[model samples]
Target: MEKYVPEKDERAPSAADTTALPTSSNERTPSMILEDLSDSGRPATEEEIKTLRHVTDQIPLRVWLVAIIAAAERFTYWSTQVTWQNYIQYRPDDEIPGILGLGQATAVTVNNAFNVVVYLLPLIIGPIADGKLGRYRTLQICTAFYLAGTCILLGCSTTPAVEAGAALPGFVVALCLTSIGLGGVQTVTTPLIADQYDETVAKIAYRKNGERVVIDRDMTIHYVYSIYYWMANAASLGMILTSLLEKYISFWGAYTLTTGVLLLSVFILWFGKPYFVLCAPSGTVIPRAFRVLWIATTSKFKLDAALPEKQLECGHEVPWDARFVKDIGSGLMAVKVCLAWPILRLCVGITSSNSIAQAGQMQTGGVPNDLLMASNAIALVLIGLVVENGLYPFLEKHRIPFREMARIATGLFFMAVSMAYGMIVQALIYKAPPCYNFPLECQGSDGRIITEPNHINVLVQLPLYILVAVSEVFAFVTGSAYAYKKAPPNMKSVLQSFYASMSGVGYLLAVALGPASKNPGLVVLWGSVTGVMGLTAMDNGQTRKDPVWHGPFAHDVPNSISAFMSQYSALSLIRGLTSRTCTYELKGVNFAYLPLARPHAVENSQPSQKALSPGLSDPASDNVHDRPSGTLDIPEGYISTGNYIPNHNIVPTSALR
Candidate 1:
């Protein structure tokens, strides 16, 4: 590691300068080189080495409580979403009655636009959670919004409200409120759940089988997310009940029950307040992060130049420390990792809107049109259980490295497979009907056009839903784990929001495809999405293997290389500027005094021993008079008089005063 010492120059003193301040013994300095564990402690014994295996730590009960809150929220949110296509497309006169008589195109468009709002609002709410309101309080407010929205939705869905023509307007307002609430809930929920278990290092532990294993925090986090997602999917089963309610009763009955569940989540959150590991809002964190990035950018992306001492040496003032810069690096890395998510989101998004419409156009028999959507939840629960409890443990026990990025890539590939299947299914649907290319526009025997669905069984859509579930088990869970683990503590919500925002972007893309979502163009839409997913999956895999990606949250280049390159490039540029600079025209500048100086050397006087070790200083020796004459007097707080200035043309502080 290189030590950064601020240069003595003709510059004004800055409050941000830490050169005069002594470093605390407890303060951890940033290190570039990876720590060598070879000499860290005593070598493991032969028996210990042979029996050692990585295992997860026991998740706290409080974590489960948080997961339950998320599950309940998902339950209510998805329950409303699963019924959206049906509610918007069909009417009471249709076999499967619906509230709004909008066509399939309008329904898919509405669903896509709703998703856009649902995922986009997180960007606004994330900063609020990290700054003004804590995660717990923000979540409470969001639940209120959600409950209010659900109530309005129920009110507008009544037969009288539909007859009175207020359903469309009321649906719009309800969706807007629900989107805001759900977006805010999603932004903070996962991050809050992750906050409960803060152990980062792996510790050795003994299992009930009398086997010694390393309790890996990373693996534990992975497991937590898996089970968390499992519960989320389990709650998604609420959509099945909502669908049934919509069929047997009315849309009002279904939404009324969902509102109650959302209310229960509120109570659960309130009771768990005492147990939750609540972190207070650091109001200035996001702004400070932006300022750090501004500094780094202005300094030509030389991050170290944004450091306090470096900024001071360059005659600039700054408010952050080196750690803040490191955190910025971590945050940027998280953003970079999520760049591939939009395509994946585009693929998975088909299920919520287009796939529901696709299934609705097929022969559903007595099944509700959107009821097949529950297959995704069911498959996710089954797959999550098998993968989390079975496959993950087996891999860990055998030391198989199925890292987060790899899992994400695998998930992407699975999504591609599902999309490919969807493209084929659409083609099959087009080919299987009496109407052929136009199933909804079939001509009856009397020469009148019949608008009936095709003869393809909706059950064939099962594989598509199941594959998407498998993909979620791999991609969505691991991507979240990657984001949560990479983000700095204060910026957890922001990073998670960044991750979630990809889904919004994907939904926005889906909105663009609204025109093609109907009829013969559906095949082309599915093919295009499948192609994009495949390409992104390949790109993600290549990124994982790329040496440029040092670690999950490191910079594009290795830290050591980035620092060295920045410093070398900066020094070279400075040397070029100094070599050519000879004169500057002064216009109306007042100078109190200009001092003529020459270099003074204290022969055979070694520098202070403290200079060898950065971030360490002896306070007793931190005095202006403690050093030889002509040496810079750097002391605590104030800049001492007679400090050496490298440029003689500039006036000394004492002379100027």
Candidate 2:
């Protein structure tokens, strides 16, 4: 392997310029960049080699606690939220008795509004976790709020107060409490799970296989989060249970069950406090971020600040440190990775609500209504396991990587792909034997009444559910992993909250199409959603190609090229084409990707050697002096490899050498 350095100062280049073709000296053909492992480590001992086995092998125990906390919270959130439309909107019948008995429009409106609040609250709470209350404490407080809300709803639902529209105001109050709590906890806990392992501390040992393996941080983080999602879905088993309770027992039973779960979660969180590695709150990055941007902007206009260095230095005698500026750049690049998330989520808002409503319309022989909507959560658990345990390890062993940007793009494509299935299901529903126009009370051709439902089975929707599940694993699980990896040490919760907010933004978009949600208009709406999502997928690809702020991603395409090549790989797919899923209920509602910059792990210079290694750094360097990690300063290349990164590209490793 050879050293390659950029001729220009890499810090200030626009995204387009940095990503444009590299100068010849540093440029590697896709072939040259695909060379063999260039590690300088000594041969592994037998005992060391024995330990190297699987990517999922050695996670710490506390990580599971965080996963439990996530799962419990998700269960409570989904159990209640899943039954909302039927509980609030559908007219009362023996099989499906109403709580609020509000009209369909009211249910949809309230649900959408509640979703907006649940997702949006993270924006405020994230800073609180980062700046004041540490993650562990914030998690505790937020969860208490969730428990409190569940108790309130349980009380209101069980008592006579819930009889009519009387319970409506109380329900609104409950929604507020749960949304604020759930949003903050969701945003903060993902980073909390990730923080369990130390990435910078790579503990290398020889595997029993005689091949040395790193107890790798990045891949471990990815794997833990995959399980995190799968576990949450498993916990969301509440969807089926609670919905059943609503249908058979009473709506109060479901709320009671959810409250119990939240209470248990709170206990476990506090019980395990001694074991958790709780990092204290680092002050908020957003305020510092604003100041940095302001300084960068003002310096651009000042006549005295001609040089890039001068611009950076101008007011920085004002508390703006170099690393903080670098962090802002990193955060921006992460934004590019997820920039398409909100727009992508528009499809989610449309489908989830519509799916529930459509199921309500289904002529089920005896199937429950909540069961159909619960499919999203169920599918997440099932497909998530297959991909994580069976597929990912296989790909890693073969050196085939699923690139972050590429996986997210695949998720976006599947968002559109799932819709295609939805369109088919809708069309089938229209053509079913019952009155196609029955929602409007249709009269048959022979003057006979078409009283019964069209005989089409609700099971036809299984395919769409499966497709959506596959998409969720591909998109959402990986998206959480990506956010954690790319976030700055201090601002992890804030970055994650930004990622979570995309769902709200997407729902905001979906809210615009509210009028068309009813029957007769639904088929047209689904078909339109499919088309728009496909275009959005293409747009996401373009964002991966070039982002707005141009920090980390602009400089880092090479590392992702192979990983992304999986979607484009010949005949090797997870499950048909749409397996690349993104985001979750609120979480899945966001994501896209761009490259990220690696900080100083790349160079070969000795710590003691102040002198350059020939063509490497200059003795008279123009860049500001960096605080030492003791490694010699080597600016990172655009593409840095990840643990499971693949040799998926057509070019052979042998060809590169």
Candidate 3:
């Protein structure tokens, strides 16, 4: 203490105030301080940066392990599905009717219905995982169900004298179990990736501070999804070989092989649990609000008083907490907005196109259709990589606003064109002989072949895949991004389910068209309808202000003030009629007269100047009122008032103000 040289002036240090610090005879500061600052200020060397990146960028090893498990699971599922109908038809000595077509159509229909549950369960399962079971544990339970289903399927195949009647029930049970398990797997895997890079610094570090990082999660998800597809193909290829082997080998051999693969998938997921970051479910406010909104929309009560105050799970008041209610209501409201346009008529056309495609595939036996299906998956994998890594970066660098809605519209147009091309191909193929011989060999009691050649019907349908692929580049990838961005964070699973539902709707339309196509004129009529719809979609896409709803009721009148008012005014002026006949008669009269009004308002109005301005600002007075209005002036050269800014030449706002 006695030897201290006034302790370096005993004050807080400053950049310019180092006067009391000890210095060498040359007047330089100590080397240690200089070195410390130099170390802090200098950019990291290449080797140092690389090392940092390696440590930070690591994805939990478990993700890769889970990916493998998922791939294997998909392999087992598709392997069974690809050959299921054929297996059922070939079962020993069974004289099944020409119902193979009916069976295939039924399978697709049943699959569509099952998908609603498959998709909807994730909503409930996600919470159960977060609240009751952990992610890893939930995976374990689901894996067991998947394994059990496979085992049951194998057992059912072995059962002697398994009549078609008995096999149906067994197959349905196995499908449901497998679907439920896979649904759980999907729900759990998505959240696991999110947990791995939950920290902001970790996300940034993993992204290497690059734009590519934003898509890193999706790339990883899809990469894992692609691996599953590849495994599925491998399994399918093996099954085809097995089908050939059936001439020399027992059916048990093929069943045993599939069972072994499924078991291995189970083992892989079980052992690799330790490396994953098992995230505890955090209480999310958004989900609570969503529940309230869902109830409001689906229930019979009014929006404000939809749920009783006592029943409101979210602590906040009903209307206040329901932010999504407005968005969803607005989206529904926008349905009417679409109905006013001629484009609304296009839904019928689009529905018809989807139906014809479906019915055509079914009638031709779904093999060519399956090949076309493969193209969509292939396109999805390629486009996801290209757009994420190539096109997006180019656009961003050039300051282009590649709006999500525009991307979706572009995709839909491609899809529409694909449908048209498919119809053209079908027209050509209608002149060729049927490709498959089995259908022609089966004869009716009159000794006439039950199925006759319709032409090279299957081959011409191949182009539909290319069209599907192009449409997917715009639809699937862009829609995935849009939904993920627009959906409330907690509703990711719900959004995925919603996306899957679109396919269900497509299938339903196909089923409906199958019966309708018995009349030859109906097929032509439907094609024309779809063509017009496609053209309308193209026109609306180019000129419309808002994105068009592509869902089931896309062309329906919105349930809004104008629609209600129109209906109310159209009602008969007669006083109360107590008789049931009178009420029925009145209902019939109302339907005949009341045409629901379409919404004319583009969107909800914004706050006017009077509402936004703080104090009175009279233009009549010469004195300029300088009250704190908080109203920002519209900067020169800016045209629109939305959140996004347009790219145009404009003076700096600071300079003008």
Which candidate wins on TM-score?
A: 1
* Model 1: worst 10 consecutive residues (lDDT sum): 582-591
lDDT of 1 by residue, 50-79 (tens): 345556667888899889989989999889
| lDDT leaderboard ranking | 1, 2, 3
Per-residue lDDT value at 501 in model 3? 42
Local distance difference test, each candidate = 0.71, 0.64, 0.43
lDDT of 3 by residue, 1-657 (tens): 000111221222234422354456765344333332322212344333322221212344565566566656655654555445345333343232211234433443444445445555666676666556766777788878877777776666654514444455666677788777877776665545444443332121212111111113333343333333333334434444433333235444555667787787677766766666665554443455566556655554334433346346556454443354444434333222222123221232232233333324334543322233444345455655566557655543432334444455555566666656655654554434442323334466787765453445454555565565555564444444444434444444444444444444444444443344332333364466457546544443221122221211122222222221232110111111111011101101110100112212111222344433332354552111222223222221122222211121222222234
Clashes of each: 0, 32, 4
Task: Estimate, for each residue in 1-657, the C-alpha lDDT of model 2 and write its tens digit.
Answer: 001212121122223432453448776432332232233133434344323333333667888988888888988888888888887875455245677767555676677767777777888988899889989999989988888888888887875776554577888788888887888888789999988865444444322222335454566778888878888988987888997888778889998888888877888887899988888997876876776656545654222232245545654344555456556655655665666777667777766677876766667666676578677777888777777777767654543435566577677777888998888788877776566734424677888655456667777787787788777788887788877776788989988889888778877767777766766777898898899887767655333322222222133221122222222221222332233221111100112211223334433222333422233243353211221233232222222232111111222222335
Regions of candidate 1 where Cα sits further than 4 Å from its true position = 1-51, 298-300, 541-557, 560-657
- Kindly indicate the candidate among 1 and 2 with the higher TM-score: 1
**Model 3 lDDT vs. the true structure?**
0.43
Model 3 weakest lDDT span, ten residues long: 586-595
For candidate 1, report its TM-score: 0.75
Model 3: per-residue Cα lDDT at residue 414:
60
